[model samples]
Target: MTTNKLEQLKQMTVVVADTGDIDAIREFAPVDATTNPSLLFKAAQLPRYQSVVRGVVDWSKTQGGDINTQLINCSDRLAVDIGAEILKIIPGTISTEVDARASFDTQATLKKAYRLIELYEQSGISSDRILIKIASTWEGIRAAELLEREGIRCNLTLLFSLQQAMACADAGIYLISPFVGRILDWYKADTGRDHYPAAEDPGVVSVKEIFNYYKAHAYDTIVMGASFRNCEEIEQLAGCDRLTISPQLLEQLKQDNAPLIRKLDPARAEAATAKISLQENLFRWSLNENPMATEKLAEGIRNFAADQRKLETLLQQFWR
Candidate 1:
């Protein structure tokens, strides 16, 4: 019996479902699941999740705050509620993202992270099983450093460059989600190219570089490749620490029975890259220098913030 690509890929990498859809999560049965504002927004609009949305809104009514505050509270609660639902089906952890609007505010990010964990704890979910997802801004990374010291794991997201990865690792973050598809998007638009082979894909190259650097330096931070554009990108990153693939790509992998080759291996990875002593100024400057990383990082934050606001608007309807 020949194993499908999804099974073969999972043999080497921890496959994570990158969606807020519970049905898709049940179908893919990934070890872990991740949700962002965009995914949560999509899930919130689905008829199946109406009860979850209403429940959060109804619960928010009893919390006693103004409409705006209540909307924020409801959005956060809904994220955790969906995550809690996903947690029931998966044996591993779930990545619930912090509000992207707080990406630059260390204190705000920390507070929101604390509140999210508090909500999860209130739901009888341990902090150990939750990874507070935050953007890879310097402030966010600092916030994560403090949270990690207090036993709160973090997933530094929207990462597009090695500098971001190094900063997260230096902070002892639990994981970093380097956006592969977004990187490819940046390059295609910049260079005006339509397609690139999987092996030579800039996004694939970026993740491989980060993965190799982490493995070579023996950094404990896990590099999870995310935001894949196609199955080829996923196939190329066969042995990453983790890969959070969307359900569409997951289905494609499940249908394809082709041989899945492992392209990344820590044992065979050898890079002479020295450890980066990244301070705030240098980290910011490096990001400023890399146009693709800079643009994509800011764009990612804006997009997530927009979706968060959209989700808030959707929840407002239930407030009445």
Candidate 2:
């Protein structure tokens, strides 16, 4: 409403907070918020959250609980505690992820998603107030489909390719978080190219193509670009459905040295004609055949899984 270049462009892109630092989230005022195991792990290790963890531990002692269960119970407690507070600042949803270790198991993923929703519900939040975050694997998509049918919205994370977006659309997910920085990382590593400008970076290219495809086909799945390296990259993606930017880049946008303009406009794509239908058989074949999607999906699941364990260990110590 300010008509400031950056603030005006924000009207087009659904800005999201890509961090666990609640103070940063408050300052930036991102519409929605997202957090994963890695971010949660980092947040827990910080001295500020020490009180929350200790409170959970004290509660566990009062209940005479199992150590492992109590520790994990503590993580669930913290995720909801922080998530609900963020929701107070922003009128949109919060993305609370399921354990990534269950990423490959459809049933386990569904079970974890249900548990996550129940945790939120217990915290006085409705299913509509939260999105169950899942990895964007075939298993994850299928699980998302099941959750969607049950009225649990999902935010598909670690998405890097068109194949993943197609599958997510097929699954009727609430949103898909395409990682811009990670995509940039892969392209830079594979192509051995440095010096990525805002408009031409491979990561920017990937999200742009996905955006054009989604708008062209009128796909209902909201594409939220994540993990950016610079404000230019974010500015270039102005027309995306949503973009989860870090506080560092958000702060950079507040300073005005150059003009900010919208790069993506839904009105411009009104003439597009392609549309898609969900086909599980086709989805499976596509995910199986795309080597990068296959490898990256597995690798992402593993990396998040590792972070989950590390956080669990830290929670164990907190319980002690």
Report the number of the highest-TM-score candidate.
1
lDDT of each: 0.95, 0.81
Which parts of model 2 are misplaced by more than 4 Å?
1-5, 60-65, 270-285
lDDT of 1 by residue, 1-320 (tens): 89999999999999999999999999999999999999999999999999999999999988988998999899999999999999999999999999999999999999999999999999999998999999999999999999999999999999999999999999999999999999999999999999999898999999999999999999999999999999999999999999999999999999999898999999988765788879999999999999999999999999999999999988898866
Per-residue accuracy of model 2 over 1-320 as CA lDDT, tens digit each: 34454576577888888888878888878888998888888988877778876776676566556777776677777777778777888889999988887887899999888877877788788999899999987888999999999888999998877878888887788899988887777777778888787788877888888888887777888989888988778888997899998788888887654666788876675423255554767766776886666666778888988988898788788644
Colliding pairs, model 2? 239-264
TM-score of every candidate relative to the true structure: 0.99, 0.91
Go through the candidates in order and give the C-alpha RMSD of each one to the true structure: 0.7, 2.4
Candidate with the greatest lDDT versus the true structure: 1
Question: Model 1 reaches what TM-score against the true structure?
Answer: 0.99
Q: Which residue pairs clash in candidate 1?
A: none
Provide the global lDDT of candidate 2 against the true structure: 0.81
